[model samples]
Target: MPVPSPYALLLSNVMVREASVSVLDSSTSYWDYGPPNADTVVVAVHGFRGEHHGLDPVVAHLSGIRVISPDLPGFGESEPLRDLTHDIAGYTAWLRAFIEALGLHAPVILGHSFGSIVVSAAVAGGVEASKVILVNPIAAPALSGPNGFLSRLTLLYYRAGRALPPKLGGALLSNWLIVRFMSLLLAQSPDRDLRRWVHDQHHTYFSRYATRDSVVEGFEASISADVSQFAPSITAPTLLIGADRDPITTVDAQRRLVELFPDARLEIIPAVGHLIHYEKPREAASAIVEFLGDGAVAVSEAAA
Candidate 1:
């Protein structure tokens, strides 16, 4: 796939060495979009098994803003943590390291799906950010509740599959099955173009190794962590985007997040799925642009 050229931007990648963190091999890829002298910086984090390209639309919409999106450890071009700490704690440490390494201060973080949870955790832990945009953030309670027997068994299969050799797992679970499985999570009546966008993301962002690793580790962590406990500690202004029709992030769960955050704005996108950014990129992007405004109004007003 051809990567589109950015307008007057700087792009680079670096391998990060963090002794305290248990990662396979950590690397960071970044793009400095728009003007070099741009004041506001937007940092986006993709969801589980997702890469930087998954945030392309959001990046494009904020053309003049400085945008930096990176592939999480074990995803995209970055190497997996050597310690295989794929849990939220590990991911958070990685984020801190990445930010410190890059010298980004209180950036406006845009998180999608699992990424939203990660950022929320960061905020809960007292990590600082100018603002937060959570797109289809996983509702903690919904994910923790009991699932069907068959669903549990299917998850077990994936767990067992993870222990198998990577090559064997890839050969057994064809990309087609992956796509079909993902489609099940999407809105049943998604537009043709939106379906294509989802398909493209499946291929481009999800690597066989990274996908399996993330699923196994992420599921365990999501169920284990009490994210609701962290909500009150988040000091950064937050924007929570939810989809009424999303199978994963239910409306109730989104509301729970809103109630927990001391400062948050909720936007429920009707008839959209968890992939709200893809299904309603323009609307989603507009909401972000409006929240993180240009000059004039004080930070207080922009946050309001």
Candidate 2:
């Protein structure tokens, strides 16, 4: 089977419009899809180093829901924060502002990888969301265990890379060869089409450096995060999706996350890695739509 383009798949389902919203001193770039007056409104947050388009695959599978995927500050077309760490607290504040600025009312917040941490923090910090969905939430220390040594080493390399001159550091961190190798190593899916699609995405989006400070700070923040303190305070219903084969955020960690939330359920996606949405968009979307309950509309007209 031929690899299907994620971008093409996304555009076929819903018309994506480029828009910008002012958040504090900076602005955020986002893609607005689906009907504006749809019954369900989903604000999807992409992972670290990911732009708004990163969630296109998942968005393609959703129907009758307004999906707003944003390129968080310092990524894609968004501007970086002037003097703030791209840490959980910082991102949580930004997310809160973004939601309020757009007048979202009890919308479902969906986050993948690093975005999961942001969503968790936002809810914990009292952002009013009807529900929260976390895909491959980072487990921090568990991510640095025996099976995660390579990832830890990579983080260290990023730290070193950040110390270099701007141009050299950007070039070193966004090297195409390195990005492709990392994508291959991280991909756990056996499907050739999905793997090829992931590789192509990495080549197109991952092998570029637009914000060095955000990359460095985001890496540090992810490693140092411990959401256990406030995760239990979240009042919104939560869905935690864990990839069984994920090397970075282990399934064990996701279970712990489930424990932290008062009203949260865990769903494990078998045989996939951290990039669950990229590898198994349909499955991920099904899990999310199911979790959303009666309010979610089924994808009756999806792109093949």
The numbered model that scores best in lDDT is 2
Worst 10 residues of 1 by lDDT: 7-16
Per-residue lDDT over 1-304 for candidate 2, one digit per residue giving the tens place of the 0 to 100 score: 4456844644585767888998878988889988888788899998878777678888877777789998878888888776677887788889999999898887999888888878878888889899988888775553446746775787878987888997888788888888888898878887787789888887777743357778888777666665555578888988888899997766777787788778989899998998887887778888888998633433433432
Provide the overall lDDT of each model, using Cα atoms, as 2-decimal numbers.
0.66, 0.79
Which ten-residue region of model 2 has the weakest summed lDDT? 295-304
| Candidate 1 lDDT over residue span 147-220, tens digit each | 33434665666677678898776654445676567755663434665575466567655653455666577655
* Deviation in Å, model 1, residue 94 alpha carbon: 0.5
* Residue 189 displacement (Å), model 1: 5.6
Residue pairs whose backbone atoms clash in candidate 1:
23-81, 23-82, 24-80, 24-81, 24-82, 25-80
